[model samples]
Target: MAVVCSKADWFVTSCSTTLVALNRKQSGEPFVFDCSKAEKKPKESDGDNKSAGEGSEEKDSDRILAFAISASGKHVVLTDDHKRLVLFCTEPSWKCISTRWVVRRCTSLAFTQAEDEVFVADKSGDVYSFSILEPQKVGELKLGHLSMLLDVTLSPDDKYIITADRDEKIRVSFRRSPYNIQAFCLGHTEFVSSLLVPAGHPDWLLSGSGDGTVKVWHYETGRRLHSVDLRKFGLDSENTEKRFAVSRIISSPDGQHVAVQCEGFPSVQLFAVDCGTEGLLNPADTLTLPLSPWDVTFDSQNQLWVLLESEDMNVLLYQHFEQHWRLCDSECPELKRITDALQTQWHLFKDSVELESRFKHLYKVNFDNMASYLQKKQERLDMENKKRAAANGTKPNKKSKTESGAVPHSTS
Candidate 1:
């Protein structure tokens, strides 16, 4: 497929099977012929389009179900319907390099920042990692979630991998040696169809589920940060009910917004996030796409690329600007209390030095650090007791208790 990534004034769309690049630069005759023909397909031919050597068997190798472009845009990793892995590099004039079979239909694929490695998750809950530079598979991690792997993604720092599965489980794994399982985020009651990591925050993960909820988590700590019900987001009403499932989620390049593409919704919905904090998606400021989309991407220029998976199968490029600010939800009392306690504790620590000056330092001690300081003081008391006991020829109470097989009694 010829992936389209354009600026704000330019948009690319497939019109009547023709890939047309439209330019809004000029209002009068604002259309540019970047590539008038969809190069991925050949010109209409009589039923004899398939030659003896180049037939359906070869076309099967050409059809790309899912793909990921390298960060450098030098390589494109693709998986075909036949569970075959392929890489198309620019150096060889768009040639497909068949690497290995994933054994099952691939649900998702991700390329690490290094662009040398690719991670593929199949329907069988098995994740395979391979080097694009090497033909051999490097590693494999199996998540025991007994369902299809909906989406797999690597952390921005490349230190961790996360997979969302049909069993409503999100499995996190360390990227390096042993590939130890980190944490399982479990809240979605149905299949989680999409996994996303925001650009600015390396610790946060987002999963959209068929259960009609979008869940967020701190991947490192396995703490669920937020959960937004799609029904509560106002898309579950009787008249404007959403028929399509959420297929993909993509964060804005600036990390201030997130776009979720659904199967039956109007289009990709853009959501705003609070600045300076890893904010969750809010109900307000939702931007609808031109059509129901299956995949979404925010490119280098901040333009939204939406893949409509209908019969026409046109890729819509939206250049609208979304204000990236999250509106704090007032209903979450627990989160409010936790955030308030944190803020108060933060201010207390910030004013610690000034507070110490108002009273005797007592070895720089205070309630905030009292527990450890008190433990040390108790150790001194225990040592003094031991010395007195030794001088008086008294057996240590702990030792006596052990000998007597009874609990010890000592004030110290």
Candidate 2:
């Protein structure tokens, strides 16, 4: 829901019907631009004759799907489910520079290395390029995959455009000449959900997928350098056929560490990037969380921010100090406010019946560990009580009471 700028000083987040920009250093009201208000007025037609309440409900359904901030942190772009793309300028003033309609709803967006052009990927398996310099022209068709795209990124030097799709394929194509196919990184067995070209190693690309593994690949040579099975950490007993997908993978801005999170697990695995090593990656640490995280990203300070998937939608911050990561007591007020607003909007828009149907399994009791935990706790309490009773010189009660003097004589 929020994308931090490469500089780490600014981030742009979609809050309800508005796109807001906040500075990491400053802490006042964020510059807000309401997308609902900025939307172009509908033309007069029979649709206008519909009930006002119905029209309002339709407008509220146009929620933002994807948003991105430029490397310079000055430009921002976001698209909603209504097939509208809006570009904004973060500096000087938070203002919508261009608002255009696209052919399909965008699944992801990224700013080119030059920051003059933006690439938008849609569910229809097409990518569109819109020029910020030439705002008058429409978005031009770019290369696309046959399957729906899940994520898109441009090489740091802007030579290749790498994209991940639902068909477990990561395609690297020439940015200038998209028709020319580069190489395909095809090891993933399921949908590739996330991709990243770390700042330190532009040649190597990191990806997370529905296969429950995070793989490092040489995008140019199509060689997989390393693969980590996340399932081993917390899903050893799960069915091998059932997917425990890696939902998000993010590298710190310094490129020294990468965070990997799975769909159902509440732990984030951290790996240190070793460009010189044969494996190219080493397990650095793991952060256990209270709830499964929906997304994770590092701030400008190299601290981690995790967005929770629960109904509260809490955003947690973890700071790295003394070579260890710990939860920060201080909070990002701006991020907190944005997430609160998002949760409210989510409740309003979410369909309870559909959600229940989709996540019925989650509601079911699967307390495989809870029973063991309670058993261990009871054992510990019993031991403590025995120690206390022994220290107080208390005798244990017997099932058979002494039968007066006859029982005492038999003992003698």
Q: Which candidate ranks first by TM-score, i.e. highest?
A: 2
Clashing pairs in 1: 244-263, 244-264, 273-326, 274-326
Per-candidate TM-scores read 0.60, 0.75
List where candidate 2 sits over 4 angstroms from the true fold. 1-7, 41-60, 235-241, 309-313, 331-412
Score each candidate by Cα lDDT. 0.57, 0.72
TM-score of 2: 0.75
For model 2 the local lDDT of residue 341 reads 48
Worst 10 residues of 1 by lDDT: 355-364
- Give the per-residue lDDT digits (tens) of candidate 1, residues 1-412: 2223333333332222122233333322222221122133223431333442234543333334466666665666656554456665534233445355555557678888887788888766778787887754534554435666778888877888888876677888887742588888888766677788887777889888766667789977789988776665556577544333565677777777677755466644567666555556664455555554444566666656554433333344455534442333423442243233323323222211221211121111226576676667666666776888899999644433233333466775
TM-score of 1: 0.60
Q: List the RMSD of every prediction in angstroms.
A: 22.4, 15.6
- Tens-digit lDDT string for candidate 2 (56-125): 3434246677888888777888888666788877777677788887766678898987898999998767
Pairs clashing in candidate 2? none
